[model samples]
Target: MSTILVTGGTGNLGALVVTRLRDQGHEVRVLSRHSPEFPVDLRDGSGLDAAMAGAEVVVHCASSPRGGDEQAAGHLIRAARRSGTVAHVVYISIVGVDVVPLGYYETKLRVERLLEGSGLGFTILRTTQFHDLVAEVVDRVAKLPVALLPKGVRVQPIAVEEVADRLAELAVAAPAGRVADMGGPEIRTLEEWGRSYLAARGRGRRVVPVPLAGKAYGGFRRGGNLTPSRAVGRTTFAEFLERRG
Candidate 1:
């Protein structure tokens, strides 16, 4: 069994990855701010060296949409290189990071490039929006009497469990830089998702499509964030809701 280190191991996706890796008989080290054993913060790289010690593989699942991801990734790469034992670094990124103009997407793209040039054996898996995130967005918008959604934006929400499974598989395999994108089984508009969410919750909120003007929104409307060909995810949005209920 190999010694693996997982960043953000307490998060929704990272926790699952850690569980899967441990289930496979690998020695998994969880590095997080709240972790009792390795309380490391990725933004500043504190306590990372100890966590990196003797780790053969690193699954980088820690990310912040509010910024600081690039810094965190840089620290991780440096720490892994310093350890000299980490052979593979697996990263989870968004599907439209390259095409989308959003700030957070731009940050993710920068992190991907950093991994590509870091000289460490690395694998990057880009996936669509998670079902929980999509559901959260719909729930937030549906709070008021009228739910305002992007006019033409589309989303392919995939289950975090499937993503965690894929990441866990990549964590142990040979490094193949920039793997194929993973997407949900269906591609639907944000409006439709919102409507479905409302119906599922038995909420009588009306979904209204708003034509938000922005390059990022334009990118979303053009389906830059979708991968219809890689719709290998099995759980549909409706199924996700049903399971939640």
Candidate 2:
């Protein structure tokens, strides 16, 4: 059995990937700040050598949601080089990250470039916004009776489970350089889904569709953050929301 090293194993996506790998019988190792506690955050490079010692694959899943500090990606590369036995590095990125100029999306794009230039065997899977995001938005909007959203913004939101499954498959496959993008089965306007979501929760919140301004808003309005052709995920927003309750 091959040994695999996972970064951010304690996170939502990373935890699923680690669990799936272990279930498949691969010897799994997780890199973390406290290798003995919480078990996630080893990209600091302190315990990387020990974490990656015998692993043949390294799945890079650690990411700052709001985005900052590109140094973390560099550290992972350094650790992999030091390990000297790593065969593949799989990176999980968001769909249309290159098109969106948002700070966090920019960071993800930069990490993709780092993977390409590192000269290591690598695979990059770009997926769409996850359905979990809907829950987050609801929670944020619940504080106010009115929620402001960008008008005409389209999104192909996939299930988090779908993204996890794809990550697991990439972790075990040969480095594909860059794989075809993946997204949810359908595309919907942000307003449409937001209304459906609030109503489902029995919340009579007013969703104001404001014309979004700035690079991030422009990109989203232009459908730069969505995947129209690579719809591979099976779960729907309605299904996900119902399941959440």
Candidate 3:
């Protein structure tokens, strides 16, 4: 079994990836500032070299959407080189990241570029929004009298576990550059998703659609966040709701 070093291994997707690697009998090293396996700061690079030593694969799941995602990826790339034995570096990215004008999305694109030029065997997997995020949005809107979402924006949300499973599979296989995009089985607008989520949970929140503008929202409005052609995930939002219930 290969030793895998997972950055951001304590967070939602990263935690799931860690579990997947462990279940497959791989030696998993979790590198996060607060991780129980190995406490390392992705920003400072403290303990990162040690965390990556002898690791056969490094699954980069760490990201800061608010900002600094590119910086974090750069740190990890340097740390991996210091270790001198990492055979592959797998990066998790979002669909349409290059098209999105948001700061976080731009940061992800920079990381992709960094990995491509790192001279390391690397694989980048861009996936759609996760079901957990969709549920969270519904819950946030539930706090208001009416569930409101931006207009003209569609999302293809895959199950977080499914993405984790795919990452694990890639971590163990030969590095393939920029694999096929992974998407949910269906695509729906934000309002449609919010309404269905509330209806599924038997909540009575009225779903309201609000117009969105600006370059940031422009990408989403034009379907930048969707990958209908690659809708490979089996789980649906309704199915996710049923599981949570």
Candidate 4:
């Protein structure tokens, strides 16, 4: 079995990736910034070499959701390239990061480009927004008597478990460059999803559709951050909610 190194192992997706790899009988190591176990941070080159030592593959799940104008991601990719021990670098990127001109998405897009330019064998898996994200928004919107949702915003929300599975598969194999974008089985609007979630929770909340004004909201409303044609992910929103219960 190969030694798999997962960055951001404490996170929702990274933790799942490490668990799956370990379940498959592979040696799995987690890299974190402050954790005593396998302490490593991609933001800087600190402890990176030690984390990558003797590892067959490095799954780069580490990232800042808050966008920044810096070269931190590039530094990490360069370090991975220099390590020479990593056979495959599986990068988890978001769908339409390139099309959506949002700040966080811009960072993700930059990181994806850095991976491609690193010249290291890499597999980039661009996935849809997590169903958990939708659930979080639904919960917050439920506080209001009428939820203010972006009109015409479409999303194909996939489960984080499915995303972890795909990332693990990519880490175990040879780099495929860029894979087909994966999303949920169904297309939905923000309002529709929020309503369904409220109904599922036996909560009463009306969805008030409003035209998105800002750049981020505009991008979402224009469907720049969603995948419609690609419906490869098996988990649905209803399945996710049921599993949560």
Give the number of the best model, judged by lDDT. 1
The models' CA-based lDDT, in order, is 0.94, 0.83, 0.90, 0.83
Q: lDDT tens digits, residues 98-194, model 1?
A: 9989999999999999999999999999999999998899889887889999898899999999999999999989999999999999899999999
Runs with alpha carbons beyond 4 Å of true place in candidate 1: none
Model 1 CA lDDT for position 44: 91
Q: Across residues 43-121, which tens digit of lDDT does each residue of candidate 2 receive?
A: 3556666677777999888777755436778877877887888989999988878988888888898999998999789
Residue-level lDDT of model 4, residues 130-222, one tens digit each, is: 999999988887788888887888889999999999898888888999999988888889889988888998987788888857888878877
Q: Which candidate model has the greater TM-score, 1 or 4?
A: 1
Reference-based lDDT, residue 5, model 4 = 83
For candidate 2, which ten residues in a row score worst on lDDT? 37-46
Error of 4 at 132 (Å): 0.4
Tell me the RMSD of model 2 versus the true structure.
Answer: 1.7
TM-score versus the correct structure, for each prediction: 0.98, 0.94, 0.97, 0.93
Candidate 1 yields a Cα-based lDDT of 0.94
Question: Against the hidden true structure, what lDDT does model 3 obtain?
Answer: 0.90
**Clashing residue pairs found in predicted model 2:** 32-40, 32-41, 32-42
Off by over 4 Å in 4: 68-70
Pairing residues by index, what is the TM-score of model 2? 0.94
